[model samples]
Target: MTSSRQQYIERYAEYAMEQMRRYGIPASITLAQGIIESADGRSPLANSANNHFGVKGTYNGNYVLADDDKPNEKFKKYDNVGQSYEDHSKVLMAQRYQQYVRKLSHDDYKGWAAGIKKGGYASDSNYVSTLVDVIEGAKLQRFDKMVIQQMNAEGKQFGVQSNPLSNNKGTKAKATGMNLPQSSYSMPVQRREFMLITSPYGQREDPINKGKTQIHHGIDIKTNKDNVLATENNGVVVGVDHRTTTGGGKTVTVEYAREDGTKTRVQYMHLSEISVKKGDTVNAGQKLGVSGNTGTRTTGEHLHFGVINVSADNKLQWVNPAAYLAEISQKGNLNIEAQHNGKNILAEYMTAGTKAVNTDEQTPENWMSKLLGSEDAALGIEGGGDKGLLGNLMQMFMTLLMLTIQMENKSKEEKMQAVSDAVINRHIDISSFVPNLKSAVLSINDKGNAVLVVNDGKKEYSHELTNAEKNSISNILQSDSDDTTKRQRIGCIVNAITFSYQASNNYEQIEAQQQSQQQTIQRR
Candidate 1:
């Protein structure tokens, strides 16, 4: 006799896998979330309405009243459990969840769980942890493997289509068989041989404050006064900071626009001199400055390079510079306009590189054998005849995999150096603030308070945000408003905070003056 959990898996595994094939959601994640949400198919909602995912709203003009977070909530009432699974896939197919569905592979259930939770699929803080636990405990990853294997067998690519509700800009390219134009990439420092990296990206000992670990946002390349620092791509200079005492002295930031209308920014720091000012358009390999030890954060003469993706709303996210450069190097092009697939090329390269490193046994030969059943099947020929068309395709695939394997063999330091050489920085404009804040860093304190640090080009102000202020900022960020609307709302909040600070300071000064006057009268 099998447990109810096992019975649940046996009954619904096919539906989960089918959904994964149709959509890019991991079968493991769907099954685990289903198990948890529907209580192993024993919940009242599941029994009465056949809803396995607790998906809200009516389904085919049918819904069941259920208590979920709030009393008397209407949960979608599906005709059958399979329909529930399909509905769950459709729910996640929304534009907001496209980042996970399109980016992550079918086997990456952990990423799927974390991404969905971060996308606000659930209000529960432990939603990701719980989903991961269910996936691991039930061994649902096998279902994900099954779907991927089937997809491979059919020669079907494993990628999700764009959400129907989202913008349909790239659809024409797919239909017409014309590739979208891609931005070219290059190394920041021109060199004859592979550039020597002084410091790599990721967690490392803080050079200035020894022993303590900190995230090195960018990699440091070994250079001298003679080595010229250059822009990695065709872009316009957005920022040039010339503070030699500390913090990335003599920084030059250039922003490159991608074919998808997104922006990538690269920053070259610790330069001895800057050749371009803000608003200057420069081509790839154009000289920006000379590498130097101008910053106090550095131990020697080198260029500190960093890259970041800038969203339309001005939010910044760091990219691994080393992985990016390694990708460009592997492509054997110093400045080649590669095809854009409506996704971050650097992110895809990093993910593929990591998979190649971690699973060395997954070679092209092994993959062909597993998917095609035998060498004979892969060759698609009989009696030792000429290699067939399938065999030629297999040969091409093997050659590609061999190249990937070679790339994987590169030292970690080399990857870091490559990425560092391609690093870009984005400049955030906070000039909309009442005091015209130049920059702002919002973070939470150890005490669970929202602390905001804003610089007004002259002085920096740190303020512990109140609940209302925090909510206002959070709401503005989470809204589906345009960039201008978001920025204006944020400016209002900043203005309010600054006014409050000024009012408190003035009140304190008046009180102190009154106290001083009282003390003088008492002495008289």
Candidate 2:
């Protein structure tokens, strides 16, 4: 059987050979580096920006922000994989690598690999060995020989005019421009909380075999056996396997039609249960199976997610699964709207802001009513009237006051713990109040007042803390606690406030309906 790695090499071998003919870089070395660096051309950089070589710096005024040695590092973006291959060649033609380009035979892939690593082309300590392994294992040198033979047949002198910038003084060459394409894709897991990539794709030490490296064809997402695995896109199920004792136990493979009219297959493996079978059409975010550890090959419970590109001739080539998910996530193709019992109320609330009020009364009861958006439903009272609203308000006030007094004499860390406990006891789901809430940070303003900054995966919203609230939070901020701890404490407080407001808003609607019914009874 032709392995996926071989299919990858076969798909891009022509491009590698072309580079060899034009730039004197060995086809074997080019192909080997591409396979390693780009994860066989399925890396996020490769899929999103056609950046197969992981080349950094600007490319024709275009770049993609990705995490590498650091967060949000800028990398060169190419119009196509061919442009990436061409640029990779140009990068190697720099003055530092001129010795390999001019001195070594084009077929000397081993020498080329060692020379490139010596020139600091890659940071990997075993880059040369890995490249040689890939080249020799796949017999990539044959492509180099074919290129040389083709040049001889065409009456062209090999390596004579290979360097396009041989006369240039600089050590590096500038990349030329090309038109780029945009991608809009989706992830297999819609919920961000369960979408953590436990084991990323590409070459890593085999989990089952100690110290032995293997090319992982897919990514493994951290998930429980009860979590329902969802389809990443609109696709038809093409294959299903239910081998519980062997490889990918109970897998479902769905084939999605790309925007460019090509087909791509996504496999959800090690499923505890399969919800869809062969020929079933599934929408994005539609449940496909329950994630599990049914497969003997798995280390624990997780979704073994794999993505493959289907060639026109029906050849399958494995691509990076995380790259596929990231492409869709970056483009906002996944409908990750927050839901509470099947209702999209959180999205509606955040988008519409606070509800409107109609009353002109300025009394204490009315003031609480206005803040809560109802006369009798200020604090979960159905029709308890003013006395009920005041009672609830007093109860809440006393609770907060007592809590504050209790924490006043405690250490800042202890105070934070108490606040966290209070927030947890409320059992508030922050996502129920703010749709796609990413983070919330508490900071002191220039005026020494507390301000809560919130990010809902789109934009930021600032909420100033009341005097009482500020006093409670100020000590925590001034403590030696880490930023993460501070953020968590702040988030707890914010969640409590948000949950209270939402509860009041919900109760206000109930009160309005009750008022309508009472008026009808009175008229009757």
TM, every model? 0.34, 0.38
**Over the stretch 16-55, how does candidate 1's per-residue lDDT look in tens digits?**
7667767878989888988998899899999999888888
Whose lDDT is greatest here?
1
lDDT of 1 at 132: 92
Q: Lowest summed-lDDT stretch of 10 residues in model 2?
A: 166-175
- For candidate 1, the lDDT comes to 0.61
RMSD of every candidate to native, in Å, equals 26.1, 21.9
lDDT of each: 0.61, 0.59
In candidate 2, clashing pairs total 1
For residues 1-524, write the lDDT of model 2, one tens digit per residue.
14668768856776676577677788899888899888876789988998889999889999999997899999998766777888898889998887655688889888888888888898789888888988888888877887776677767665543322211111111111101124334456545322434455554567887865554677776455544544444579999888898778889888877555567778888898888889988766677888888877887677788777665555554555543443443344343332111122112212123222222222332232222222212222234334422343333432332333342466433443333322212211233223336765444333333355666564556677786775555555566876556546755677676556556667988999999999999999
Please report the TM-score between candidate 2 and the true structure: 0.38
